[model samples]
Target: MSNRSTRARIGRRVMVHTPVGGSRSVMMGAVAAVTLATLVTGCGGKSQDHPSSSAAGNPAIGKLPQATTFANLKNVAKDSGADAAGNGTVAHPTAAVPVSATPGGPPVATLPDKELGGPTWVPVVETKPGWQRVLLPSRPNGATGWIPAGKMHTAHSPYVVKVDTSARRLSLLKSGQSLGTWTVAVGAPKTPTPAGRTFIMASLAPAKATYSPLILPVGAHSESLDTFGGGPGTVAFHGWPQKSVFGQAVTHGCIRVPADALQQLAKVPLGTPVSISN
Candidate 1:
């Protein structure tokens, strides 16, 4: 009945689904693989129970931004000027919207309006007239899909998180200005942190706050582990109590930041862009 006991139970449940061939020792001391959708309240205080997938429906075709070829869908990082301007745009689906492989194309997937009990806010990487190409929180890193822009709410996030895996550093930026840079811990060489552009998928306060007071799940998933802790191998930015781990590569795939850094990051809004580089 105590909070500690409750958290212990949750932690145990999450750790039950370890990697296929990995031992308990291998998973120990790594980031806890808590289920993103079930563990905690997200930015909007909602919880989701399913992963992003296709929904059965004939989606309405709206006026597309432009007549670009399907090839453009592969260019996930080519934002019209959002990334370059240092202020990325975020999109929120007003409803469960159908996603297309290309602008005005047939529905490939249906994007839920919420994830982890919060508003599903995704970074808009590319744009056509009535369509916006946004990052997806599904399998295959760097996945993107086009959705009708007219049916979504839009906002610009001034905060950007940059992690340099090679240097073991994390930087926070706002409005093209650096807030601060700190030494952080990245993934080990074998289970290396994936390098790409992702957004803050959700913010969670775990029941067991011993490992970290807060966890910021990103859109990216672990490349090495198909499943961890009874959930998809989703990576995150969290605090590590061990000071010695700073500036080291010794995690499963999460970025371990200092207490101060975590405090600052906890304020960052979900859907803000995060750029991880080698």
Candidate 2:
């Protein structure tokens, strides 16, 4: 997996994939070579450490063990809620927090503290008495996991990103007000972008700054391609130098936005909810 500082050159027409899932890197110049890899299964690349089982506690009782993995947990249910107006909440883990399959079940993985070199912020989808269901960046799109709500800090994000693939448009909303909408590129027919609820997992700046000034990786992956450019087929929102690419379904799985749209999206914080609909 590539680190934040990993620099590499990509040619025009090459599918840009971040080394770590949920973090994308793009390069710009005459050649359009990019630095940084694409987003992976988790907000970061595969985790090297696992949470100590000795620290395990029941989430139903408001106690959680140390959290840790992007690969171990699966079968998480898809988030079916509508776009949160102004009450959307994001969670920031103070430490690695264990994720469980059920409220009192054994933990399946741990949530990390950071992703793409930035603080890890996950969107809370559902809330129980002691547990909060959060959207995970792992594969099998729409994957979700349960974490102890008391173990992490929470904040509200008024921003919501809505994408209409059929219309090839992207809209930004703040506090239920429309910020603006712009035409953007979507996934090709062969590699369609998976639609569902996700969050902005990371914001990255490449070394070259040619293709785009910044790459905003979302917590969603490609449905067709398991991997691309040596990274998990993580989808992202980024700017394309060619204005003609906007409003066209030509990308592998990433959303190619216009310069203006990218500028507006850059201000949106990570963990802001993104809703993609067909």
Candidate 3:
């Protein structure tokens, strides 16, 4: 048995050694002293074998989950695909290798909220290895802002940004891992262009086959967004407009990262990362 358990047995043995009534008072005092010592030991004071908390090690740690929308930022059901929940990974920003938590342990405890940073910091692999949720803290107070852990890698965390423009090919990157290349569309010379690091500000998969073609001529189909004032550079990477010349630049500025890529891109929530450039 564990050290604490063993000591309790010893205490019982000591009390059993007490003699007759003449030595009763003295033995009673000794038993009381031994009992007090046992209590302290059981609580993990002097015994090195006890399974105290410190000895158990802090095991409740993980990355913050991806939020549903950039609007209210709440926990909601996620979509399906490579970016599915538990599909997101932990990595050093790029070179990711998946990892899981110790099974049968306690669920994640409440942590603090921290400001989100990114849409600028881009790296294929993290120099220092560790996992940190973009929003959840990893500790109690100082850790509350965003939860981060060393055990997780790039295959089971969360992704906050993704883009796929169908010009000649498309590019799909999650968290930091890449799903290979894909052809995409770009805005024509007439349509300036909207290229920069952007996140999933919002998304909507209409109950019907809703599509926006006019203003987005020659580009991917519409996937409503919380783009600038919810318009103009309303960045959305989607499928081709049936009658539209998708392989050509015809957007008002939104980077036309092709349509078929939408299913994969849609997996990310608002605030997920995105990078747009020529």
Index of the highest-lDDT prediction: 2
Q: Taking the tens digit of each residue's C-alpha lDDT, what string does model 2 give over 138-237?
A: 6657767789879889998889999999899999999889999999989878778778888888888866564677878788877765444434556889
**Candidate 3 root-mean-square deviation in Å:** 27.0
**Shift in Å, residue 79, candidate 3:** 30
Each candidate's number of clashing pairs is 7, 20, 47
lDDT of 1 by residue, 1-278 (tens): 01111222333423231112222322322233333322331211122235323232533422221111111123333233335223488888866776787898876556667776667888888889989888877655777788887877889889999999999999999887999999998888877898888888888886656467788888887787554444555778988767888898877788889999999998888789889989
Candidate order by TM-score, decreasing, is 2, 1, 3
**Model 2 CA RMSD to the hidden true structure, in angstroms:** 8.1
Q: What do the candidate models score in CA lDDT, each in turn?
A: 0.66, 0.67, 0.31
Which has the better TM-score: candidate 1, or candidate 2?
2
Residue 107 in model 2: lDDT: 68
Better of 2 and 3 by lDDT: 2
